[model samples]
Target: MTFRPISIFLSPNTEKDDVQLASKLLFKPWLWKKGKEILKFEEKFKKYLGARYAFSFNSGRSSLIAILEAMDIKKGDEVLLQGFTCNAAVNPILAKEAKPIFVDVDETINMNPEDLKTKITKNSKIVMIQHTFGWPAKIEEIKKITQESGLYLIEDCAHSLGAKYLPSQISKKLRRAKKLCGTFSDAAFFSFGRDKIISCVYGGMAVTNNKKIGENLKEFQKKMNYPSNFWIIQQLLHPVLMNYLILPFYNFLKLGRIFLALFLNLRLLSKSVVRIENRGELPSYFPQKLPNALTLLALNQFKKIERFNQHRQDIAKLYKENLEKRFILPFAREDKNREPIFMRYPLLVDDSDKILTKFKRRGIYLDDAWRKSPIVPPATDLKKIGYIQGSCCEAEKIAKHILNLPTHINISPNQAQKIIKLLLNAQ
Candidate 1:
């Protein structure tokens, strides 16, 4: 049997008009990394999320750092965060010299609100909630708990760009409000990384409803040096190149990851460019400002995010209908009036090595592991960060078994079925 590879990123077909629009940035090199595009991106993003304030950054890790800087989460402070998320989210806590307290996630792979309540202490100053894989974590309950405990909330909306939070209690003001995923918390951040819902290749946004947090982010931005023009050009043009050339040959791309590891080791590639589950020490470039051209690159995709995300939902619905009972699927929390972006459909298997090998031979690709760390980056010893073992047992177990399959809009219904068939029969 001949195998057809499926892709989650690099799935979208290239549009000539989109390419022409992007070319406008290259034409005017003067505006390549300017404040004008950055301002425009923020304004439009703020309006779209209905957020009062929005600021762009070079990466989500930078946005997280600015949020912590704003909250004054310093050494001796405890930041309660779920262990089952990207290490980028927690690195900022350490950058602030604060200790991170691990919280367990529920079946949804989101921070369990019950576990959140248990982790808070007098030293706990902030709580970072990740809307894992576009699933809105128990937002209302967690928000209420954080508010009562006097902990500031930072919604890591990187995986959930358009995912929303529907309030259970609809008061007069709440009735008119749209509780988008990033807007529900004190301050939130979104990523435009290579694999995010809308990839601008490299960028992030810091958003908030509070004026003080906005000012703090601005102060942080003032200190950041702009990214290199070569890097900006590379990031700007990579998306279309990916969609047109690389993604179709994803298995080859998977093989190329070994070369990437070599490049990272040789220092030919920036460590920040490719994230690893166990990259021991973070690069010093965590907190940086966005380039004007990259913001323009992000804006082009942002305009089409809603449409792109809809296709993702259609694919997810198909997977939900077809893959049931065959696999231990991700959380399907009810009463979620908002739609999840469904970045990828998560699967929990007993033996990941068996599943990964079965698909790799068949030319199907899956995420290495949805972070194989109870405290993401399994190599990081909790004792080093002042966290204890046995704090989040479920996270450690799930990390070992969990992997995500592609749900890119490019996946045809027939292709999706092929994937379902493979996943169902793999074990």
Candidate 2:
């Protein structure tokens, strides 16, 4: 077999048309914002989620910032989120000057509603429920908890675009109709980063069904400015440069690795999380409007949402059927109506390091990239991010043993079989 790298960010969603468009738009960076593409993308996204309103931003963190601002999240107020997450999720709460109370996750790799109940206090204003790796959280139970506590609930759909949850008979208190992830909360935000279900290199969307929150979101969006032309150029160049300069040379003498580091160091490409964000400081440009150029790419991928998600579901099934009894796949089973997009298939193994090293040696680059710790970017200081170690024992234990396998559209069934076979052999 010819060796090829299988990684989510290695041009997984960037197709020929996307690259062609990005290349063409590179020279027209001056026309990057306030274009018809932005409005069209938002309208289509709203329709997709059956939401009353949608607003675009430069990143999912920016979208969350908009949601928090619109909700009037103020100083000393508490924002509760589960422990297994990224700084992208936590930094936004910090940006709003709110306290982030870490909640432990369950076997689903999502918020434990019981833990959520224990964490609530009079100061709590919102609960940010994440569909980690596209596994739907115990939303029905969690929603009921938030309702009883009178706390606003926001769905962090950054990892779960196109996923659905059908309420079970026991959850009849919730509307029994099937609901999309973003629709269940007061407001939800999605990421279109390079590795998300869809890619615009860097983009996000915020959606709300609440009329008052919708109006607030609209007003907040109006106050935000589009990113600068130079910044727009940086995003526009991402796919084109990576496809041309990075991936092709990546395994050849490690040239791609060197170029990636050089580009990030020289600021030719933007790091998904800036150094300061991991340090819990929000950058000035973190809360800007999504540029029209990037919105165009988002629209391109958004059109193929079903195709992308269907492929992911299929790959997840392969893992479920083939890797059974060999490894612990925590997020594999769901109720009939709950259709998860499965951005990455979560597996709990005895030694995460050993399995990851074995996969890497065989040309499969899957790793616990996002949730390496209770908070991500692994180097992030938990204290600075307000995570008290040992407070989330379940999350801390899962962090040490979790492995994520790629299930993006780029991985064909044949490639998925290879991954599954290798995983079984590893055990």
Candidate 3:
């Protein structure tokens, strides 16, 4: 049984053009670390989202660290965040010597505003909301809660780039004004990791509309050094290496898998989640500036942002319109105001691991978008990461049942239909 692997990330997210760009940049060693590409990307990204200021970072987690530092988060200050998220989101709080208050998530796989209200304390200074899997959380309700409590709102827009939130009730002047997820909060951060809305191998940006906060964020950015040229080359080599060395032989006698392991072992390919991050510890390289090389790849992806998002939306619509009635869908298509740019269409199944195995055998790869834990990489110790068992019951349950289907730009309508048929049969 030989066929091309429909990977969740490796090949599906890598375009021919992306590989070409990386290949060209690999030879231009002078442009590898410092250049105007960084400034250009930041300018274009801020303008795209209507933000006043934007600062780039080494990763999404790095961006969060800068946000926390800029806001003066210190020992004992509580940062409220929901469960069913990556430790990448939580570790930044710990890095600042602040306490992380875990809030439960509603069906949107985002923070439950009701549960959020219960967790606020006098020490709680910030409320961080994750737009999980490109679905906007109940931002309007949460915004009101944060405002009444006098807590800063930070939107984790790692999974959501073009996703929007349309409120049901609005003033006549602002009626029907659907807002992008990152803009509604005091500050927001975006990821350009391999599996995100856009891929630059690894990168992030922190943006704010507030004059003072933006200035503070810039100061923090100025203090950090650019990533080493060696690190920059490693990131640039990712897509190029994957396309040529690994993806082609991935399923052929498991040769691709072997090549991938070999590269990772030889230190040529980088792992998205590093060893220290899973332990709720910050890496030495964090909070650094986003190098110029990766921005070339990111800026290229930015050009196709609309096309990428629309493709995901269309695939999500197809899934919503066709999946079996028994399957629990992520969003209500009937709510015209509640638009979700589905990074991956999530379904709650009886046994996620079992279903994933069946799909993998058929050359379709599926897995839980966030790992099967309150904090991702499931190996993370709950006590070490400030989560207790049964803390967020809904998120814990969802972690066991969540199965993500690919909705990236590479998936075709026909392929989606076939995937739907496979899912129905698997049931």
Candidate 4:
């Protein structure tokens, strides 16, 4: 029997078409940033998300930074956010010269409204709500608190592009309308990165119903330079690497782990990777515009979102039937309209180290990489990142115990069985 390693990413059948689309466009160098592609993609995306306006960025960090800037969040202002989230969500708060006040998360691995109410200070000007792993936070409750307190709400929809957080018990009349994650907040952002549900190597978008935020975002973008040709080429080369080398080749991942260890030990990737940026604090200035290459890649992937998301939903159902009760899992509330996208199926266990070791031995990928620290990638100071010690007890516990399985379209039935087998055997 072959040592089958279940990888989370499925090599897209559209990889050839993606490469072809990129090839035809590469000859038109002037079209790099000047083309209708970016604007067209933005228009389609805004309609898809039910947002009134959209602005593309080079990365999620850039989008969030722009949001803070647009909101005029300045020195001494506090931006309250969940402690148990990626550093990309927190770095922008630090970058804007404003202080980040860490809030705790509930079982959803998202912002806890109760904890949020307690953490708000007189200086608190914004609330950053993240739908971690596409598990919707108690949005209606959080929104009410932010509204009553006069705080701006910014949703981090990086992991939850298609997720719906239906109306909570606000009113029977309002409960019928289902709200997407990005639409519910004052402003929101999405990431199309290597591992995100909408993979395009690297790209992000800032969206808003607020005319002011939309206007400010366009103004800020006007001054930004387009990504260089070399950078574009690298993005163009992703399909081959992802589809051919990374997803199907178990040996590549095994060797990649060794390479990663060497890279970390030799300080290759950049020390502040844990913080989602190279420096613990963001630079005074960074590239903020979306590259044409990423946009082109994103456009190709955008067409297939429905099919892939449906597959992800199917995989989540299978996992629930097999792995429920044996592990702590995420689900929608009483509202039938609310459904998690299941970007990654999260489970809290006794010892992640032991489980990670067991899965590794079998070439089965359980996500140990998502939460090395509360800010992820291990060996980072929560204090430096603006999180106070002993403030988020639940987040801290969830961080240590949480692990996830990939629910991408590429995972087959046999691979899921192996994952279930491994998870059930846990002591």
Q: Per-residue lDDT of 1-427 in model 4, one digit per residue for the tens?
A: 4333565533322356775666666566666665667898899999999888899887777888878888888898999988877766777777777888888888778888998989898999999988988877788889899999999999988888888867755488886767788988899989886678776666789999999988998887787777666556555555544443444444554654554455445533222233435245664324468876668778888998887788788888878888876877755234475777888877777898898888877776665367656776555557677777778888888888887888876677677777888889976
- TM-score of every model? 0.88, 0.95, 0.97, 0.89
Model 2 TM-score relative to the real fold: 0.95
TM-score of 3: 0.97
On TM-score, the candidate that comes out on top is 3
**What does the lDDT read for residue 369 in candidate 2?**
68
Which prediction has more favorable lDDT, 2 or 4?
2
Cα RMSD, each candidate: 3.4, 2.1, 1.5, 3.5
Error (Å) of candidate 4 at residue 382 is: 1.9
Candidate 1: regions farther than 4 A off: 1-4, 9-28, 172-178, 240-280, 336-338, 377-387
Question: How far off is model 3, as Cα RMSD?
Answer: 1.5
Clashes of each: 2, 0, 2, 1
Query: What does candidate 1's lDDT look like per residue over 1-427, in tens digits?
Result: 3222565444232345555555566567787776687889999999999888888898898888888898877788988888776667767777777887889989888899998887788898988889888988888888899889988989999899988766878787676555678988899999988778876666899999898988988888888888777666655455444433444444564644454455445544343334432342456556778888877777878888877788878888888887767777875444446667788778777877777778767776664445466665556555655456678888888888887777664668788888788877876
Best first by lDDT, ranked: 3, 2, 4, 1
Stretches of model 4 off by over 4 angstroms after superposition: 1-5, 9-16, 19-31, 168-175, 246-248, 252-279, 283-285, 332-337
Model 2 over residues 1-427: C-alpha lDDT tens digits? Answer: 3324777557678777898999999878566887888889999998888889999999999999999998999999999999989988999899888999999999988999999989999999999999998888888899999899999999999999988898665365775667789988999999999889899988999999998899999999999998888788888888888888887777777788788889877888877777787789988888999988999999989888999999898998998998867888887665776778899888888887887788777656775466568788688889999999998999998888888888887788998888887878887
Q: Higher lDDT: candidate 1 or 2?
A: 2
